[model samples]
Structure formats: structure tokens, C-alpha cells
Target chain A: MALEKQSRAAFWVTVLPPTLWIAVFFLIPLGIVWAYSFGHNEGLTGVAITGTFDNYIRAFDPLYLQIFGKSIAVAGLTTLLCLIIGFPVALAIVFANEKMRPLLLLLVMLPFWTNLLIRTYALIAVLRTEGFANWTLAWFWNQGSTLAALVGLQPFPAYQPLELLYNNFAVVVGLVYVHLPFMVLPLYAALDRLDKSLMEASLDLGAGHLRTLFSIVVPLALPGIVSGVIITFVPALGAYLTPDLLGGTDSQMIANVIERQFKRANDWPFGAALSFLLMYATFAAIALRAYLTRGQPADGHGI
Target chain B: MDQLAQRTQDAAAHKPIISFRNIVKRFGSMTAVDNVSLDIMPGEFFALLGPSGCGKTTLLRMLAGFEVPTEGSVLIDGQDMGETPPNKRPVNMVFQSYAVFPHMNVADNVAYGLKIDGLPKDEIKARVQEALDLVQLGPLAARKPDQLSGGQRQRVALARALIKRPKVLLLDEPLSALDAKLREAMRFELSQLQQKVGITFIMVTHDQDEALAIASRIAVMHKGAIAQLGTPSDLYEFPASRFVADFIGSVNMFEGTLIKDGADEAVIACPDLAPYSVHLPHSAPGSAGASVWVAIRPEKLNLHKNASEPPAVPDCPPAHNVARGEIKEISYLGDSSIFHVQLSSGQLLRVSRPNRSRYEQEHFGWGDTVWVSWAGSSPVVLLS
Candidate 1:
């Protein structure tokens, strides 16, 4: 009896740290968010802790709804663009000849070795008005004017250089570039596992190349594609860095709004409520993805 | 069943389906398939038998259109297959690994080719059902590949390839994945299935027993070349070279230099055995000075009491081919007995005899003195 008691005590002792850590760090914070979602914020000074539905009601207002919709659209576009550009690159790396594959894979992962913010900043130097592209365009325009005077008609109209900095397009490009390797790595892993004979079998059965890709390759690779999308989409939905640096005032996302409420706006209760809403939205998207692919193997959980 | 059998009989009367002309395939620095030529008659069961890396699978793949020949042309029904892709070719293959789609159920797997060819829905369903029934997998049509046994999956692969009703069906080691007992049973079933379907079935396998059992003609390949191509009995009874004789089955070989050649007989003085004369189909007088290996199957030799006493025998044996040896060991398997004997010149010869009821009464144990001898026509002369 004494030995049994000592063994039971040892089991709990071993399990206590991780159990307490999860309860303290995850469950407690979630409970606090749940509590704050029901509470009302007082003006400026503090929040008067009381149960209310006003915060959720305000969250669904046109202003906030528009931001939420825009966030979804932007994140969806980013994910689609990443998939389009990443899949073929991943395929090339995976199917390259033995000696070249390691070098190609290294090139794909090289961008991730540096700080992500530094990489995004590097793009600013290339796309800005005073950058290399604009300088080349200016040089071409001057040459065209001189040639027009010599033999051609009037020179083309003087063009103001492209204004790409601090725009939603830049934000989208940045999101795709930053999140591309995440998408490609998973896709490479999945495509590498696919049987080469299956492709041969499809070709042997009278399906042409395009037909085989759509019918056999695409459907079989749906798991990997979905994983890549989730990996890019979920983080992109709550992204703040790219938008803060590249987007205009009108292009601010829900995550930027939440950040503003916590640090700049100083609305702790409202920020907590917004954070809970973001968490719920992410969870809902995951649940819906699971529900759609219910019976597929390895489909339920999002990466 | 009767209707299916009748259809198979009707299909068997068809003419030559596929032919090959000097096909060659190379991979970078290695020649996977050397220049090869063959013709596959309609509804014939043909086999390509060889060890691993012997280009048998490459040849099979070339016929399936998964691989294109580096040199010569392949024709299906006299149609040039050079420009034809695998799907357009009237051929289908059962892959070596049984490449059944894991996500698909048995019916869908069998129906894949029909659907890909844009068959009508009703026709696809009917054909899939027919194929499932043909392979005796009708009851498991709804189960996925992982849910079935290895043999069942192999049947599904076979059914999938056969349902296309192509002019030719290629199978690459279809029975290699099964256990010994199941492989034996499936070999008989596959042979019967081919006869029933009456498609030109070409299979590649390393197992000699499988080739001998199912093939109407077997092509033994070695080092990217066809060593011998003939009926199984022709190969077993009269192998053309030392490689074929040594590879096909268990045979006792004696190395010797040919000494004398006549119109019907040639004498070889073995360096390690008694000089013996062997009957030849034709005069090989110039081949006397060349080194040769004489081969005799273990079952052909008979055991006698004394070496010198057998100057004549009542069995109407051929003249001049006889050897005497002492039995060194006896191996008693249930249905037969194998005797390992040592000749006076220290060459060992193995002799196998059926364990008949009368023979069982006279058992030869280890360390027995016995004469091993065979008629002149029994041993095959191999020059390589």
C-alpha cells in the first residue's frame, strides 16, 4: 500500500509542471479574454467590469466589419499568390537531378536565414521612387527624347515614376515573399512522397498531360495544398508588420487595429475583446476546413 | 462463366498483335536495353526472365510505352508506335509494385481506365463489375486497397490492367509480392486467366518456375541481351549456351576440351572426369580444339553397382556416354532422393531419382558405393 502511494505520488510529480504551465499560460489567459469580452469599458480612465453585449455589438459595426472583410480578402490573395509562385518552384527543387537538388533547396531557404523585417526593408530600397528601376526608366526617357528630335516624332509624355511604396500592393507582395518558403516546404514534402508510378499509370491509362495533372495529381495533392494555404493564411490574417510598414491609412488590418487599441489607444478591455474575436475567427476557419474535408486522411487538423 | 469462356475462345483466334524491331534503350552512360528484336504473337503468353538489372523490366516498359527505344521501332498491329504516347498506345501494364491507388476502392480502381477513356457511365459500371468478377474480387469491390490482402490487391491491379481490353497486357513481376503458396496458386490462375481473356500477355519475372509454368515461350535475358528465346521445354531440354544451362535449373557440369567430332557424335575428354562421347545434332569437327562444358540434368543419370560392368544395358541406351562414381551422400526428400557421388577423378556429380514405392524398398544411405551413368543423348554439350 505504501509503495502504491509513493508511485502515484511520483507520477503526479512528473506531470505537474507541464499541466500547471498550460493551465496558467493558456487556459487562464483564455478565461480572462472570455471574461473581458462580456465586460464594458469605461471612458479614458479605466474599464468598469460588468457583463454586457455592447462590445460584440460594436465589433459588428460597418467600420469594423469592413476591416475584417478587407483582412480576409488581403490574406486570401496573399495565400493564392504564394501558392501560384511556390508550387512550381517546390516541384522543380524536389524533382531536380540529385546533384542540383540540395543547392536549389538551399536557395529556397536562404531568405529565411536573415531577419524577416530586414528582408522586407530590403524590398523598400528596390521599389522606392529613387531606386534602381526608376533610375533606369529616367535614363530611357532621356534617350528617347534625344532620338525623337533627330529622326522621330515628339518624345513621349514626361512620366512621373511609379509610386509603389506604402500601398496595399506592396503589402501583398511582402506577405507573399515572406510566407512563400513556408508554403513551398510543405508542398515539396508532399509531392516528394507521391509515387512516380501513379503518374505513369495515369499516362498509361489514356489521360493526356493536362488531364492527368487535374484528375490525378491535383486531387492527390489536395492535402498538401490545404496545409500550405493554412500555413500562409492563418498568420497572414492576423499580420501587422507588413501592413504597418507598407499599407496606407485605409489599408489597416484588424491586427493593426487591435495593436492600436492596446498600446496607442489605451483601451485594454476593447483590445482584449478584439483579440478574442481574432482568435475565434481563426478557430472558425480551421473548424470549417476540417468540416469540409471530414473523411479525408490527415485532413482534419490544420498545420 | 460459360459465356466468358466462349468470348475468350473467340478472342484467341486473332492474328499477331504487337512486334518489336531492334529496340534499344540507354540511360546516360549505361545501356539499359541493348539492340533487341522480338515479335509477340496474338494471345500468346510470353515471358522475359532474367536476374535483377538484366534489362527485362526495361524491355517490358518499352512495350508498355512508359519507355521509348533509343534505336529501333515498336509496332502494335503494324502501327508505328514511335509517335504514340503511353495512353494512346493499345497497351496497359501491371506495375511491379502492383501500383494500385490507395485512395480508390476496388471498383473505382478497376474502372479508372474506362472513365479516363470517356466511356459512358453505364458501360463503365458494367465493365468494372465484369472485371471484378473476372478476378474473383466481386465481393470486395467496395473496399479500399489497404483494406485487402496482398493477393487481393494484386488481383485488383491485374483486373485494372485487363479491363482496358488492350491489344496487349504487360505484367512486371505480378506474383513477386505474394508468399510462396499464394504465388504458386496465382501462377496457375493467371495462366488460366490469360487463356480465358486471350490477350497477348507479356510478363517479366526473375523466378524461373514462374516462367516455365505460365509462359508459352520464355526469353531468358542476361546483361542487356537475350541469352535464349524458346519454348520452356526447348530451353530445359536443349539449352544453347553454358549461361542458359547453368541459369535455368540444377545441372551437373563438367569442363572439358572437345577431342573428336563425327557426323552424329562428338567426344570430349574432360580434364576432371572420364572421357565421354556426346551425340550432336550436326557436325562440329572444327569445335574439337575449343574448351567446352558438358551439362547433364540430375534426373537423367541412373545409379549402377559397378562402373566397368555397364558395357551394355537393356534400356537401349546410347553408346559412349557413361560415367562411374561412388555415392558420397544421400538426401532423402519425401518424393525423391538425391545422390551426391564422387568420380575417380575427384569430380562430383549429383543424381536425382524418384522415390517410387519399389525404390523406397532399396534405400541408398550416405557413404555407399554406386555407379552413376547416363546415355550419350542425355547430357547436353555447351560451348561458350
Candidate 2:
């Protein structure tokens, strides 16, 4: 009995610290959010302790539903664009000459070394109405108008420049640029581990280049592409800084709405409900990804 | 099968199936394959035998269309394959690793080439079944490569390569991955399969035993060049140079100077062994004052006790090659004994003798004085 007690003490001593840390940091915050989602909102001051489902019902309101739909659209677009530009670049990097591969990989990751916020702001500097793009447009218009006037014809009607800042297009561009490396790095690693003999076997068996790529390369690389999509899509869905700096009310995402409810409207309970909905959506997306990729063997497991 | 053999016979009657005319392959500053000219007859089992990095695989790859020669050209069926890509070539290769597709089953793997050619589904199925049956793998048609044993995977690779019905089949060390027993079994199986298919078989291997067992003609490669090309027995009996003599099998080489030359024989005084005369078709160049080497196989030297009378010499001449030595060590293999004998000049010579009986009845222990002798025409004289 004494020896059994001593062994039990040793086991608990080894596991207690990490268990306590997880409970305090992760479980406690999740419990607070779950509790707040069920409480009632007070009159513009704070939340009341009365248990209710009113906040959950209000989360599905049409106005908020529109923001949810728009968020999905923007994130989906970002994922699609990243895949289009990243797959080829990753393939080039993985199969390049040994001496050039490291240099190419460094070039791909160069943007991440700088401050991410500074990189996003740099996009604003380039795409703003008075930025380099507009300057070039203005110069083209001036040249065309001068040539028309010189030919003894009336110049084209003057047009005002359009605003590009505070829009959904700028937000999408920022998300794609920020998340592209995430997509490319995983893809490069996956392609690097693929056996070269598999491709040769396919070719020797008389499959053309396109058939080999579609039937063999794509199926083998599906797991990597799925992971890349998840990495780019989940973060873009809940993005706050990009939408806030480069989007107006027309482009407000669920994250921005939650922020408004907490800081501006003083409705902490409703904000907490909205946060729970976002969390549930992210969880559902992850479960769907897992179901799709369950058949793929883990790295180094299958042939 | 008879029809295929007849077709192969007809093809051989017309022209060579594959030909390499002064082929050379260079990678940057390194020359992997020098000027190699060879012709492979149809229905013939030809082997390119060499050590590693001796350009045998590179030569095989050139024939497979995976590589193109930097100089000269490769020909299949008298048509130059200078610019033909691998996919368009009428040849297929079983890669050194087998190169079996992990995602594909045996039947699907064998049918891949026909499917790519857009054949009818029924025809593809029938041909796949036929190929699998040819390799005796019809029962395992639905299994993936990883699910099969090493020998089974090898058959699958062979089936996949042969289903295309190419003019020639290239095997790049196909049995190198099998265990010793399996490798021996597959060597015989591969030879019988080639006879059944009746297509030209070009194999590359470093194992001399494997080459001699399967190949009708063998090309010994050294330093990106063919040292000698002949039948297995021809190469074994009359190796053209010291390289071929030493590479093909175990040989005891003794450096010597030619002392006299006759019409069909020459006497050589070896610095390390007893003097010997070898019969040849032509006298050695610079016969009287030139250096030469005599190669005698270990099994050709006979070891007898000193108390026993020496065997009478043959009609050609007396026992020209004879030496007296003391047994230094004896290795008692179950069926044979390998005796390491130290001669009077302190050179150790190895002689293998059959046990022929129980160890207690017929055995040569250590530290026994022995007489070793050979006939005049036993050793081959290497001029180079």
C-alpha cells in the first residue's frame, strides 16, 4: 500500500503542471465564453445574469447573416487565388537545381521577414487613389487628351478618379498576399517527399504528361492542397485588421461586427454569442477537412 | 509461343534488333560512356557486365531512350532513335528499382501503357491478363506492389514492361534486389521467360555469375569501354586481357618474361611461380624479351602429398608448371576444402579440392608439405 501510493504521487507530479496550464489558459477562457453566450444583455451597460437564448437567436439575424456570407466569399476567393499562384512556384522551388533551391526558397519567404502590418500598409500605399497606379492612369489620360486636342477634335470627357481604399477588393488582395507563403511552403514540402520513380513509371507505362499529372500528381498532392486551403481560409474568415483598415461598412466581416458589439455598442453578451458562432463555424470547417483527408496516409506512412 | 519464336527467328534472319554505333555519353566534364559499338541480335540474351560506375547502366539507359548519346546514334529495327523521346520509342525498360507504381494494382499497372494508347477496354483487359499470365502472376493481379514480396514485385515490373510488346526489353539489374536464393531462381526464370517471349533481352549487371547464367553473349565493360565481348565459355577460357581474366572469375596472375617462342607455344619465366609454356594461335609480340603474365585458375592447380608419385605429363610436354609448397591453412567447407599453400618463394597459392568423402577419410590438415602441379597448356598467357 505504501509503494502504490508513492508511484501514484510520482505519476501525478509528472503530469500536473501541463494539465493545470491547459485548464487555466484554454478551458477557463472557453468556459467564460460559453457562459456569456447564454446570459442576457443589459441596457447598454453590461450583461445580466438571467439565462436566455435571445443572444443566440439574434446572432442569426439577416444583417449579420449577410456579413457571414460575405466573409465566406472573401476567404474562399483568397484561398482560390493563393492556390493558383502558389502551386507552380512551389514545384519550381522543389525541383530546381540543388544550388539554386535554397536561394529560391529564401526569396519566397523574404516578405515574411518584414513586419506583416508594414507589408499590408505597403499595399495600401500602392493601390490608393493618389498612389502610383492613379498617377500612371492620370498620365495616360493626359497624353490621350493632348493628342485629341492636337488633331483638332474635342478632348475626351473629363472623368473623376475612383477610390480603391476601404473596399472588399483591397482586403482580398491583402489576405492573399499575406497567406501565400503558407500555401507554398506546405506544397513544396509535400512535392519534395514524392518519389521521382513514380513519375518515371507512369511515363514509361506510356501515360502522357498531362495524364500523369492529373491521375498521379494531383491525387498524391490532394492532402497538401487541402491543408494549404485550410491554413489560408480559416485565418481570412476571422480577419479583423485587414478588413478594418481597407474596408468600409459595406465590407464588414463577422469579426468587425463582434468588435463593434463589444467596444462600441457595449453588448458583451451578444458579442460573445457572435464569437461562439464564429468558433463553431471554424470547428465545422476543420471537421469537414478532416473527413476529406482521412483516407490519405500520414507523411512517411504509405509508400 | 511457337509463333512468337518463329517471328523472332525471322527477325534475326533479317537484321540486328538493337545497335549502338560509336555511342558516347558525357555529363558536363565527366564522360560516363565512351565510344561503345555493339549489336544485339533478336532472340538473343545479351548482358552488359561491369562494376559500378563503369557505364553499363548509362549504356542501357541510352538504349531505353531515357538518355541520348552525345556522339553517334542508337538504332532499333534499323531505324535511328536519335530524337525519339521515351514515350515514343518502341522499347521499354525494367528499371533497377523495379519502378512499380505504388498506387496501382498489378493488372492496372500492366494495362497502363495500353490505356495510354487509347486501346479498346476489352483489348486492354485481355492483354493485361495475358501479360500477367506470362509472368505467372495472374493470381496476384489485384494486389499492390507493397503488398507483394520482392520476387512478386519483380514479376509485376516485368509484366508491366512486356505488355507493351516492344521490339526489345531492357532489364537493369532486375534481380539485384532479391535475396541470394531468390536471385538464383529468378535468373533461371528470366532466361526461360526470354526464350518464351522470343524478344531481344539486354540486361545490365555487375554480378558475373548472374551474367554467365542468363546471357548468351556477354560484354565486359571497364572504364566506359567494352573490354571484351564473347560467349560465357569463350570469355572464361580465353580472356583477351588481364582485366577480363581477373574480372570474370578468380585467377592467380604471375608476372613473367617470355624466354622462347615456338610455332604454337611460348615459354615464359615467371618471377614468382614455376616456368610454364602456353599454347596459343599466334606467338607473343616481342616474344624473346617482352613482359607477360600467366593466369591459372585456382581449381586448375592440383595439390598432392610429397610421398605420392607425380602424375605423368601429357603428350604435349612434361608438367611445365609445377611448384612445391607447405600448407599454411586449410578451410574445411562441407563439400570442399580450400588449401592456402605457401611456396618455397613465400608466395601463397590457393587450391580448391573436392572432399569426395567424410572429413576423417579425406582431409588436408595444416603444416603439411605438398606438391602442386599443372599441365603446360593449363594457364592462359595475358599479353597486356
Candidate 3:
């Protein structure tokens, strides 16, 4: 009985540190947010717990609703783009020869060595007007005209730069660029563990490359896909930095609105409420992902 | 009369279902399969038997269109398969892992190939039902592959491959994943299923017993080349080389030299035991004075306490074919007991005796002096 008691004490000793850390850092801060969401605000600075639903009601306002919808759209589009671009990169790394695989994975993760803010700024240099994109376009346009004169056709007109930066498109581009490795690493891990024999069996069973890719590879890699979407989508939903630097007035997401509430408008309760709203949505996505991938085996377990 | 004549002529002109012509596969500096040629007959259950890295699986994969030969060609039904993709080939394979699709249930897995062929919905449903019933998995068609046991998953793989009814079916170590009892059961099931379906099956396996039990003909491969190919009994009893003789089953080998190479019999002189005489299997491949190894099966050698036992050869002395040994160990298998006897020449010879009687006439225990002997036809001469 004394030994059993000692083992129980040992178990709690091992578990105490991380539990205390989470309780202090995460649960306590969240409780503060939840309590503040129900409180009434004093003039400019003070807060008191009157327990009203007024802040939540204001969260459903048409202006805020529009911001939420736009945030969802931007996050959804960014996730879709990441999946589209990152899946092929992951597959290439998985299927590459042994000597080249490490180099390719290193390149995928190399972006993380630098600060994301610096990377977003670097994208600005390439995406702004009269930047590298338009210069390349102008060079191609000049070449088209030169070739047109050489062929004795009509001469083409000069090029003008496309409006490429400071919009929703720029925000999505920045988000996708920043979070692509997040999408790829999980997918690469899942695909690397997949049995190559299953792919061969698919082909031997008369599935073409495209059909096999859709039916076998994607479904077998569903857990990774779910986690990749979660990793990319949740952050993209609550994104503040990319939209702040790359977005204009029309392209502001909910994070920008929440930022205005706290730092600019000095409405801390409303900002906390909006922050909880985003957290609730992310929680729902995580729960749905858990429910969907509950029984999925990480390694390919079947034919 | 006309129908019979035409049928006989057609049988005479029947071509092989698959053929490998001077095939060679090389990976960088290493040759995986070297100058291999073979023809698989229609409806014949063939096996490629070898140790790991002997290129048996490489040969099987080349036939499945997973690997193309570096030199020469592969022909299926007399058509060149060099440029054909795996999905376009008229062959299906059951992988060693049984490669069941994890996402789909059993019925969907069985119906996959037919669905890809754009078959009508009812036909596919009926075929899937039939295939599942064939594997006796009709009741569990809705269960996922992970939910099934190892044996059930293997049956699902079989059902899926057989549903397509391809010209050839390739199995790569299909029974290696099952437990011992399940492997034996599946071996019987595989042989019976092959006979029932009448589709050509070419299996690659390292288990010699499995190949012997299921295959109509076996090809024993060594280092990317076929060392011997024959029926199981021929390979077991009249093995052409030392490798085949030792690989197929346990044998007592005596290093010897051919003393007399005659048309009717060949005599081998060994320092251990007695001079061995083997009834030559027509046209044995060696000359007089050539070094050879004499291999004799354990069951062929009879153990006795004395040389005065009756019904023995009266023309030759018993010492010419007998050796004196002391029993060192006894292994009591249920059906038979094997005795490891140490000869006076320091050779350990294994002798298997059946436990035919509940009360034996005599019991031979360890440290008993015994005489081990065989007839002239029992030993096979291996030249390699």
C-alpha cells in the first residue's frame, strides 16, 4: 500500500509541471477573456462585471458580420491555395530519390529560418508596382513586339504594370506564402509513411495515375490533410500581420477590426469578445477534424 | 472427326500466356536480373523460389509491368509489353502486404477495377457480390480492411484480384504475412482457388515448402539466375546441384569423387561411410574422376542394431552401404521422431523414423550404437 501511494505521488510529480503551466498561461487568460466578454465597460479604461449579452449582440452587427464573412473567405481561399500548391511539393519530396529528398525538404523549411515579417516585406518588394513581376512582364511584352516586327506583323503596344499589391489578393498571397511549409511538412510526413506497394497494387488493379492519386493517395493521407488545413486555416483566420501590411481599407479582415477595437478604438471588451468568437470557430474546426479523423490510422494499415 | 482434328491442331499451336525473352534488369552498377528467359503456360500455377535478393521478386515485378527490363523484351499473349503502362496491362497482382485500400470497405475494394472500367452499376454490384461470396466474405462486405483480421484481408486481396479475371495473376509472397496455421490454411485455399479459377498464377516466394505444396512447377533461383527448374518431387529427390539438394530439404552430404561412370550405375568413393553407388538417371552430367557430392535423404537410410537383419541385399556385403554410429540426440515430433546420430567419422546424420505403433518392438534411445544404411538407388550425385 505504501508503494502504491509512492507510485501515485510519482505520477502526479511527472504531470504537475505542464499542467500548472497550461492552467496559468492558457486557462487563466481564457477565463479572463470569458469573464470580460460579459462585463460592462467604464469610460475609456475601467471594466466591471455586470453580466450583459450586449457585446455578443454587437458582434452580430452587420458591419462586424461582414468582417467575419470576409475573414472566413480569405482564410478559406488561403487554405485552398496552400493545399493546391503544397500537395504537389509534398508528393515530389516524398517520391524524390534518396540523395535529393533531404535537400528538397530543407528548401521547404528554409523559409522558416528568417522572420515571417521579413519574408512578408520581401514579398512586398516583388509584388509592388514596378517590381520584379511587372519588370518581367514588361520584358516579355517587349520581346513580343520585337518578334512581331521580325515576323512583319503589327507592332504591339507598350506594357503597363498590373495593380498587384495592397488588396485581398495580396493578403492571400502573403498568407499562402507564409504558411506553405505548415501545409507541406505534415503532408510529407503522411505520404512518406504510405506503403509504396499500395500504389503499385492500385496501378496493377487498373487505376491510372490520376485515378490513383485521387482515390488512394488523397484518402490515405486524409489525416495529414485535415491537420494541414487546421494548421493553415486557423492561423489564416486569426491573421493580423499579413493583412495589416499587405491589405488596404477594403480588404481588412476581422483581426484588423479587433486590433482597431483594442489599440485604436480602446474597446477592450469588444476586442476580447471578437477574439473569443474567432477562438470558438477554431475550436469547432478542431473538433470536427478530430471527429472525422478519429479512426484513421497514421500508417497505411490496409490494402 | 473434323472438330476433333481442329481441336488437336489448336492445342498443338497454343502459345504461352507470358514470355520473358533474354531479359536483364540493372540498377546502376548492380544487375538485379541477368539474362533470364522463361515461358509461363496458360492455367499453370508456377512459382519462383529463392532466398532474398535472388531476383525472384524482380522477375515477378517485371512481368507485372512494375519494372521494365534493361535489355530484351517481355511479351504477354505474344504482344510486346515494353511501352505498356501497368494499368493497361492484362495482369493483376496481390502484393505481399495484401495492399488493401484502407478507405474503402470490402465490397468497394472488390468492385474498384470494374468501376474503373466504367461497367454498369448493376453488373459491378453483381460481380462484387459474386467475388465476395467466392472468398466467403459476403457477410462482412461493409467492414473496412483494418477491421478485418490478417486472413480476411488476404482473402479480400484475392477476391479483388480475381474479380478482374485478367490473363495472368501474380502473387508476391502472399502468405508470408499470415501466422503459421493461417498460412497453411491459406496455402490450401490458394491452390484450390487457382484450380477453380483456371487463371495462370505466378507466385514469388522464399518458402520452399509453400512452393512445393502449391506450385505445379518451381524455379529455384540463385544470384539472379535459375539454378534449377522442375517438378517438386524431381527437385527434392533428384536435385541437379548441391544448392538445390540442400535448399529444398535436409540431406546428408558426403564429399566424394566419381570412381566409375557407367551407363547403368555411377560409383562415388568417399573417405567417410562406404563407397556410394547411384543408379544413373539417364545421361548424368559428369565424367569419371570428377569431384562430386553424394546426397541422401534421411528417411531413405534405415537404422538397425545388427547386420544380420533379414530381407537385406544378399549379393553385396552390408558394410558397403552401412555406417556405424552412436545416437546423439532425439527429436520427438508428433508423427515421427528424428534421431541425430554421430558416425565414427565425426559426421552427424539425421534419420527420421515414423512412430507407427503405440508400443514399439524396440526403442532406440540416445547413445545407442546403430547401423545406418540405404540402397544403391537412394543417393543422388550432385556435381556442383
* Per-model TM-score versus the true fold: 0.86, 0.87, 0.92
Report the number of the highest-DockQ candidate.
3
Q: For model 2, how does the per-residue alpha-carbon lDDT over B1-384 read when each residue is reduced to its tens digit?
A: 465477568655778888899998999898988999988888889999999999999998887777889999999989999978777888888988887877678898888889899999999999999999999999999997878998998899899999999888999998999999999999999999999998889999999999999999899999999999888987898899999999998788888888887777777777676543443334665568789888888878888777554444554445456777899998878787788989777888888888786645645678998877776667888888
Candidate 1, position A94, lDDT: 70
Q: Candidate 3 lDDT, tens digit per residue, B192-218? A: 999889999999999999999999889
Give the runs in model 3 whose Cα sits over 4 Å from its true position.
A1-13, A149-156, A294-303, B1-13, B274-285, B306-318
* Docking model 1 quality class: acceptable
Quick one: ranking by TM-score, best first? 3, 2, 1
Instruction: Give the fraction of native contacts in model 2.
Output: 0.49
User: Distance from true position, residue B262, model 2, in Å?
Assistant: 2.3
Candidate 1 pairs with clashing backbones: none
Highest TM-score scorer: 3
Model 1 / residue B237 / CA error / Å:
1.6
Estimate, for each residue in A80-189, the C-alpha lDDT of model 2 and write its tens digit. 99999999988889779999999999988999899978987898887798877677788889889989999998997774566777788888888888889989988888
lDDT of 2: 0.84
User: What tens digits encode model 1's per-residue C-alpha lDDT throughout B28-77?
Assistant: 98998888887778878999998999999999888778788999998888
